[model samples]
Target: MSDEDIAPGSDVEQEVLDDEPKSILLGIIGQLRKGGDLSRVTLPTFVLEPRSMTERITDFMSHPELINNAPLNTDPVGRFADVVAYFLSGWHIKPKGVKKPYNPVLGEFFRCRWDFEDGSTAYYVCEQVSHHPPVSVYFYANPQNDIWISGHVRPASKFLGNSAATLMRGTHHVQFKRSWPGEEYTVTLPNVYARGILFGSMYLELGDSVVLKCPKNDLVADIDFQTKGFFTGVYNGVKGRIKRESSGEVIYNIAGKWTDSIQFTKASTSEKKTVFNAATAQIHTKVPPAEDAQEEFEARKLWERVTKGITTKNLDYATKEKTAIEDNQRVILKERAAKGVTWQPRFFTGPVDDDWSFGLKE
Candidate 1:
C-alpha cells in the first residue's frame, strides 16, 4: 500500500511516530528547558541554497562520448548497467525526499505585543523552496485576495558549529516570505493573554492541507490541519488569566480550568478600565491577582522581552559590537521600566561650535 493508506494505529504508523521522539520532546519542552540531554533540542538553523540542473549535470559520466565508446561484446545486462551508470554519473546527488537535512530550531518565542490587533506570528522553520511544490493554499475566497504583501527573509547571523553562537551563513541564504491579510476591524491582545488566536479572512477546516515553502531552496513542506480554524500560540505565562471573545460572548477563558461560553465579571479596576462598550465583544487579559508574586513576575518578564526586541533595533551604535552592547543595555532599561523605575534616557544632539572665538559677543 502507498504511505497514506497506512492506518494511524498500524505498526507502520507506530514506527513512524516512534522514530522521532526528539522532535516531540522539543515541541513539548520548548526553549527554556534545561539539562544536558535537552540541550540537543536547540539546533543550528541554516538556509539551503539553490543549485541549477545544468551545473548539477555537467560532471556526470553519462556524457554521450563516454557511453558510446563501450565494448561491443558487452552483454545486454552489462550494457544496461553501463547505460544506468552513465545517466547516474552527474546528477548532483542529495536525498530526494524527507531524508533531506532538517535543522529543527527552538525558534525564539515572544509574546505578541500588538495591542491594537489580536494576532499570532509564527516563524516556521522549514526547507527553503522557491517554487510552489506540491502544496495547497486556502483563504476567504475573495477576488481581492486575503494575502498581504510578501516580504523576504533578511540576512541574519545564525549560530554555527552546533553551539548557539551565530555565524554568518551565506550571501545567498535561504529564501522565505511572510504575508498577512487585511481585516476590517482592529482587535486587541492584552499583556496577560496566555494564548493568542488570530482570525483570517479565510477559514480552513481540519485535515485540509497547506504548504509552506522554504526560501533558500525549492523545498516545500506540507502541513496538515490537525484542528480546524485559526493558528494558536499558547503563552508560557501560567499565573495570569486569559479570555477570548467573538461578538458579545466569551468564547474561551483559561483560569483555574479552561471554560467556554462564559461571561467575565470585571476582576479589577484595571480590567474594567480597558473594557469596550460596543454591541458585544470578547476580551482576554491579565488581571494580576493581588499578592500573586509568581504570576506578576512572569507577566513582567514577558512584557520586558517584547518591549526590548521592539525597541533595540532602532537604536544607533558606533559599531556592530556597540549595537549589540546597546541592545543588552536596553533590556536592562526595559526591566527597570517594568518595575516602575522612573528613569528615562537623557537626549542630546551634537555639540554646536563653541563661541570661544568671541564672534557671538561681537
Candidate 2:
C-alpha cells in the first residue's frame, strides 16, 4: 500500500502544492543557507497539517492498548519489551507528506481523553511552555490502569542542502503507578529528517538513535532508525538490541521496518516473535471536548478558523487567520513586557534545570 493509504485523513490533497505555494517555497528556499535554523522561518499555510504541535504530540498515545496492560506483566523484561513496542507504534501515524503542525503559541494547551473498550479512560494534557526554542510539555494518565507518562519536546529545525531535520531533544518518563510505582523508564527521541525537500519526491524519515532505559531494571534498548540513502538503502528500517546495563549483555535483538512490522529475537534461545505490526494495529481515537466548549487558549479552539480554512482548501483565508493568531500572541507578549509581568504556561512549569514538566501531577 502507498503511504497515503495508511495515513489517516489521507483523502485530503496534502502532498502536492499549488503553483503559488511552490513559488513561495522556492523563494524561501533561495534565501535559506545550508544548516540555517528554521525556527523563525514562516512557512506557507499549505505545508501545515491542520493541527497544533501541542495536540500533535498526542500521536504517541494513539496505540494506548499496547501499554494499558503493561504493568500487569510481572517480568521486567516482558514489561520493557512492551514499552518498546508502544514507543515504536507512534511513528507510523504521520501525515502523507512533508508537513509540519502549527508552532503553538506560548501558553497554548490541548486536552483530550481516550475511552478504552474496557471502560477505563486515559487523560492527556499538553501545553506550549516556551515559544522561542519551542518546548512543549505534556502529561498522560490512566489512573485506573496505573499508567502515566510525562515528557517535554524541544524540536530544533535546520535546513540541509536537500533536506531539513528536526532534532528532537526531549525525555519521556513512563511509570506504572500501581505495578512499580516509582520505577520510571526514561525514553529519548529520534531526529526527524525530511528528505528531498529541494528536489525529488519529498518524504519524511526518522533517523539517529532512540534510547529507552530503566535504571532500576538495568535494561536499555538502543534502537536506531535508519534513513534511506540517496541511491540505496530501504526506508523505515530499524535495528536495535536490548542489553543489560551492568554487564552489557545482549538480551534481545530487534530488527524490522517501523512502518510495517518490528520483531524481536531472544538472544539466548534465538526465538523470534513479532512485537508490533503497524498495518494490523488499530489506532484508538482521542476525544477532545467540542470546540465551542474549549477554552480560548485550547489548541482546537485557538486554531479553529485556520484549521477550517486548511481543511476546506482555502489557503488564503487560512494564511490570514494564522497570521492573526500569531500577531495576537505578539501583542500579548508585548503587553506583558510593558507591565513588567512574565507570561506563564497554564498547564506546565519549569525548564528550571532545562526540564519543562506538567504542573498538575497526581
Candidate 3:
C-alpha cells in the first residue's frame, strides 16, 4: 500500500498522512478477506484501543449508582426490574468499529474505581487468567452499597463474512445487600457481532440471547438482542420479559435499545417506567496515567510504548513495541514451563464458579 492507493486530496489521504497507522488498515482488511484468524494474527497497532481487555470489561460497572439504587424499588419484582435496567445501561459503551483491542497477555491485570454522583464509589479489578482460550476474570464492588459483580468469560473470535464476531461464554453474578442477601442474580454476557468489514461504514451489536435470573427467587429475565439484518431489522433492538421460575408468570416486559433506555411495564397494571435512560446517565471513562500507574501491572504502563506509537501515528514504533511485549511474554512462559513452574492468577485463584457467589454470604 502506498500514498497513491490512499486516494489523494481526500479524507483518507489526509487522515493517512496525519497518521500512518491509518494506512496499514488496508493490510488488515486484506488479511481478513483471506480468512486470517484474528486470534493468531498480528493486528496493526494503530487501530489499538490503548487499553487492556481487563480495563475494557469494566465498562459493565461504569454505572454503579444504578445498582446502589436497587433497594429503592422496595418490591422484589420491582427491584429485579431495576436490576435489568442497570444491566442494559452499559451495552452500548463502545462504538462499532473494525478496530480490535489487543489480546491480553497472561496474568495481565487492571484495577480502577469510579466516584458516583451520590458520593458512592465503585471499584473494579480484572485479571487475564488464561491466554490460549483468552479468559478474563473481573470483579466490581461498591462496599458502601454492598454490591458486587464477579465473572470469568472466555471469548472466542471468528470471521463471519463481513463481520468479526466474538462469543462471550461465562456468567457474572450480581449480589445486592439487604435482609435478603441470600438470593443472588446471575447474568450472562451476550455475543458481540460487529459488521462493516468490506465497506467503510461499520456498526456493532450485542447479538443472540442473554438472561438474568435468581435461583432463590426463581425469577428470570429473558432478553433477546436483535441484530440488524443485511438491510432490515433494528440496530439495537432489545426485548425481553421478567417471568416467574415456577409458573412462568410474566411480571414485567422490558423493551428498548440497550444504548438508550429500557422500559419495564408491569404485567398487572401495564404501568410503564423507564428505569435506565443513558442520555442523562453518568458514565466513568477515566484511568490512571502511565506515569502514575505501577511499573507493569497497570495497562497504561504495560502498553505505554504501543499507546505512544498509535498516538504519535508511528506505526513502526507501535508494531515494534507491541511485538516486543508479546515476545517477552512468550519467552517468559517458555522459561517457566522448562523450569516446571506454573503460573497462577493473582486475584482469581480458585474455580471461577466460586466467583458467582464469591464474596456473598449464604
Candidate 4:
C-alpha cells in the first residue's frame, strides 16, 4: 500500500466484514486458549490493515513539528514537555475497529522521507529485524532541525477470553543532535488491547502506563492511558503528571482524551492550556517512492499483490496472495538453515544486548 492509502482521511476506517464468516472466525478462536501467543497463528485476511508493521511505525513520526523547536527551548522542563506532547500525538492516528498490520517477514524494510514546508526534510527507515517473536526497529532523523529518534517495538500478543492484548515492549530515545548532544529523553509505549475479539463489536484500546524520562534534565512524565472498563470509565482517557525526578515534585497536571485534546495544568499557578488537539493538529504528509521504484524486499513491493486484492474487495484473492508470500518465506528460511547461514537485516543491526540500532551513520 502507498503512503496515501493509510494517510489521514483515507477510507481505512470503513470496516470490511464481507470476507470474514462467523463460523470461520469462531473455529479459529476455538483452537486458541486464553493467554495463548498469537505470533505464529494465521489470521483472517479481513482483519489486516493492508500495510506492514514496519510502515506502521511511521505513524509516530507523523507530527515531527511537535518537537521541532525542542532544541531551542532554554528551559529543560519545557523541552521535556515538548517530548511528552510529541509522544501523545501519534496515538490518535489509527484505523477504526480492531485491525492488525501485516507481520513483516525477516529483513523486510520500508523507507520514506518527509519534506517540511521550510525546505527541511526528515527521513525514516525501518526493518523487520526478527521474525519469531516479531521485532521491528526504526530510525528517524531531521538533520537540519538536529532531531533524531531511534526505537524498536516488540509486540507480544495474548488471547484473553473475549479480548486480545499486545504487550508492547521497547524504548524510543529522542535526542537533539547538535544541542544537548548527550542528553536524551527515553520513552516507553502503552500496551494495546483489542476488545470483543470473540463476540460483540471488536474495537481497539491502549491501556497501562508510559513514562518519558530524561536523566540529564532530571525531569519525567508519568502518563496512564486509561481504558474503559465494564460500564465504567471512558475510552482514550489519559492522565498524568510532569514532575522533578529529584524531588518528586509535580510541576504540571496532564488531563485529556488522546483521541481528542490534551491539556496541561501548572501546579503552582493553576493555569490550564491545551497542549495538543487531535481535531486540529495537522498530520504532516509523508512521501514514499512509487511501488515500482522500491526494492524487491521493500514492504509495499513484497505485499503488492495482497494489497491490491484487499483494496479491490477481492479478499479471497488477498488470502491466496498472502499465503503465497508466507509459504515462500518458509522455503527461504529452510534453505538458509540448510546452508548454515543467518538472515541479516539491511537497515538495522543487533539484538546487541537485546537491542537493535540503525546500522548506518546518522
Instruction: Estimate TM-scores for all models.
Output: 0.15, 0.94, 0.85, 0.93
Q: Count the backbone clashes (under 3 Å) in each candidate.
A: 16, 0, 0, 0
| Stretches of model 3 off by over 4 angstroms after superposition | 1-37, 71-73, 285-290, 352-362
Candidate 2, run of 10 with poorest lDDT: 5-14
* Segments of candidate 2 deviating more than 4 angstroms: 1-18
Residue 347 deviation, candidate 2, in Å?
A: 1.6
For candidate 2, the lDDT comes to: 0.87
Point out where model 1 deviates above 4 Å: 1-45, 53-66, 70-75, 91-131, 134-362
What local distance difference test score does each model get?
0.22, 0.87, 0.73, 0.86
Look at candidate 2 and tell me the lDDT of residue 154: 94
State which candidate, 2 or 3, has the greater lDDT: 2
lDDT of candidate 3 over 99-204, digit per residue (tens)? 5677889888777777766777777877787889788888887777767778888788777766778888886888775635786898988898656544444556
lDDT of 4 by residue, 40-156 (tens): 889888788889999999989878778988899989989999989999999899987788999999889899999998678999999888888899999999999889999999999
Per-residue lDDT tens digits for candidate 1, residues 208-237, read: 223322222222222222321123421111
Clashing pairs in 3: none
